[model samples]
Target chain A: MSECTKLEMKDLLPDLARGALAGPALAALEDHLATCASCRAELELVRAAQTVLGATPSVDTARIAAAVGRSSSIRRDATVAVAQARRRRAWSVAAPSRRVWLAAASIVAAVGVSVIASNTTRSPVEPGPAPTVAQVEQPSTPGPTTPEPTRPAAPRSTGRAELVMAGGVSDLADADLESLLRVLDDVDTELDVEPAVLLPVLEGDV
Target chain B: MTEPTRDGEPSDAALIARWRGGDERAATILVERHAPAVSRFVASMGERGEVEEVVQDTFVRAFGSLDRFREASSLRTWLFSIARNLCRDRARANRRAPTVVAIDETHLLSSSDPLSAAVATETESRLRAAMERLTETQRAVFTLRVAEGWSYREIADVVETTEGAARVHYHNAVRLVKEYLDE
Candidate 1:
């Protein structure tokens, strides 16, 4: 309760309760306990808790060990299988680092708000006035790629590559685009993995 | 069976390396040494029904991810953290986790006499009740320090709080348990 005059020894009540104190420390605690009513009561509380919660319930360790062994064996086998499968698919699979993932996330988030979220935007990191770098070129008409049931077919291509890729990039916005442009300035690795990851996230978040 | 290896026996590090090298018995020894404390901690979290299961899961999960474990850190604290997380997940799945509260139960001096065994027996149920009333983090913070005499830093590692926050939770738990006891 912090009311004990011998306040410094109070934190050690649990140790005293566990019989961890001995020699000079034990003597010192005893001397403090003889005078401090606050600490004595706290020590009592500590003991009561020890007695109540300290009773270790029996657990079946052998059973658990056997289960763990089986789990480990299965996992090892599965890992081996996965390694073989990975070797087979090594050409298709690209595991990006966390830094790469964050950069990609920034790009995806920016795309939903702005049309300018593209790799070509001039990075502020480079010294000079901002260049009129190519933006994520938008389809001027932006006609729905899928013709509406009520409307006739959209004009051919509408000068947009979106019609070919199912329009994932066009659906993104501007807020994260600026960030993507900035990150593109700093971390160039995201550029290599961008085309692979950007499409799926755009479809999901949009 | 719950007793740890005595002073002259192989250290936890050696056992861990052996276990990593596929010595199954080392895993068994680790389980034996840590199961009791893990059981007590899980039970204190008010997840009493699944204490054994949670303990088993803790070891299994820990063993599975031992490669990620920092080699020099205390394995016991790491196991405690994993058990704490498993219990929290169970509570979340059950939708029974109470929000953390800072309880103040000051001025509960019960005549200052040394507590007797009879009193300890009588208060056992109340103590259990008091423990149940504590927030999960409080119980996690309190039990490790009180029952095991762990440092606040160790408790912090288990409970996922800074050492200062662990100290505050420990005191708050002490006060709350006293309040429950007085009632």
Candidate 2:
């Protein structure tokens, strides 16, 4: 029989010691070990080390359980603290939407323009020939004053048309100015009515 | 709390699921079942006096990150991987602090059974010193193989190496340890 190489025997030594080798492999390994002094010695050393290492003292399970209990309590408290902090952060930042901001900006701009228009109209100027009371009272009707169009129409009177042209608000009709102010009033009312709903929607986004 | 079945205890996955569902006892059961093995693993890696603390930390960290555990590996293997990392961290921290000394047989001989303890302590001291001579990977592979009776595949998983490399490390470790003990 051929002598077993140390490398081949090294691979088999642990299995041999543990009785894992079976059938012809076991018989072959045993035959090889019978003549191999170094492999025998190496196997002995491995077994000895395994035995020594396996003798490590058992741990105290009760103490570990107690420690785990303490750790879990601490972790629970930390988690609760973190969740509370997140909630506080959510409440502190009322992030309005781009649409809401746009609406708000439109209202502010409209109010500023209205204020300027009213101020300019009221301003003292060199007295020109004042309009006759009859002209003011007659109500310069341009077309049949049909019930207000669902959408804004071009300014009908020359005076109104001049105001639109000078203001550069091509889309504005005298009647639609009242509608824009009403829409702004509705938006302001909605904001005041539902402050609570705003927070959950923003938090969901977060 | 679900009562443990009479035929056998629940699996680790079941326990983890229970723990996630708010049954604290499941967490306790998991700790009790796996803590000793983790402690032994840490101790084998040359950690002493604080094996319990490390094992506790491992469980706490494991539970905290339970959602990340895919259950692809056995829970015990996962715990060993965590314990190995904790050992590495502790070793680094201890290196930074000059005051801490490594524990040895003297620390282990505190048992009431003096005669057997003496014999065991001597053997353990020689083995530990021999292990100390090995590189970290060699020591880990050897200990996991011999001390923990792990297969090369399992050792590879814990040490983050291929099975062939783990076997190579184990053999090299065995030779070095044998030479050290022989001397």
Candidate 3:
């Protein structure tokens, strides 16, 4: 037999024993192996191995599923543990700052308490008598009893526009202002519509 | 709550979205659905003591990195990948310890008579011993193929090897296992 044929025969021997060969190929391989004792022994060994392997119990799907469930739980706990560890690390880093803030707040509070205590320990100062309203109404007293100095101006008539513009204001462009007023008027008119018809129209708009 | 979607069952994608939106039920559903697969994978790899804990860690890691998981493979496959890595880490950590045969007691009882089962267990123990004798890569290739029934291509993808190399490993593994068994 040719070298290529020998090689093909060796590969085919396993297939033949496994019943994987078919048609003319099976016939040719059978004819070659009939006279080949070495090939026959190899085929027997391959067959035995296949049988042994085939007899291996099919892994239990339920068991697999159970294992998968266990795996998921383990993974979840690990993640939670890792997250907890990170939180612990972060809290550790923040602890000194928290103490510093507490110290600062305590210092401020202590100073405040000391100031209040000092103020309370001292004697209270007496005040002069309060001024009468009639004394305050006198505009040109020029003495200790006189009211604080004032800049006096003559009263003038205030128009509606002047009162409206008293607060610093923008004069909008006429067309834009008119459109805004028209929108507001439309909104008012729409609000006056009956509830029944307004509902569908509002729904449609939405 | 809104009515169930037209498909009867909400898709995983929908469930994922709901979980992301803070639906606790969705999170629970996801956990209940996929946790067993991870557990079985770790168990098959001979993990014990804290198998459930490992499974939980795998899920939490998967959830935290759910954003990075670009649906390139099925969700199960993705989870398996995560689980496999976790198993590897656990295996490395325990390399110095004496290996323990942690076969399920019930599985051992249900497997034929006590004598035959004991012998089978011995054989399995031998097989495991032989497995230990092989390099980690060889054991991984052999287990993923023989135990998990992965195709060579699938093995290559999981093990990050060329397809041709995977085939060679499979052949090598078969030969080694047979030799070990015969002994």
Best TM-score among the predictions, by candidate number: 2
Per-candidate count of clashing residue pairs (backbone under 3 Å): 10, 0, 23
| Distance from true location, Cα of A19 in model 1, Å | 0.9
Please state the CAPRI-style docking class of candidate 2: acceptable
What's the TM-score of every candidate structure?
0.63, 0.65, 0.44
How would you order the candidates by DockQ, starting with the best? 2, 1, 3
> Could you tell me how far off, in angstroms, the CA of residue A136 lies in candidate 3 after the best superposition?
42
**Candidate 2 residue lDDT tens string, B21-73:** 87888888888787766777787787877777788778867776676776777
Ranking of candidates on TM-score, top first = 2, 1, 3
Give the worst 10-residue stretch by lDDT in candidate 1 chain A. A197-206
Candidate 2: C-alpha lDDT: 0.67
**What's the DockQ of model 1?**
0.28
Model 2: residues with Cα > 4 Å off, grouped in runs: A1-9, A12-29, A73-103, A106-206, B1-7, B99-103, B106-124
- Summarize candidate 2's per-residue lDDT along A1-206 as a digit string, tens digits: 23235676677677666666798888887887888877788777667666655554566667666665665565566566556656655543433343366556555554455445444434457233333222233357465533423212544344444334334332245666577567556545544433342343223211
Task: Please give the DockQ score of every candidate, comma-separated.
Answer: 0.28, 0.34, 0.09
The whole-model lDDT of each prediction reads 0.68, 0.67, 0.54
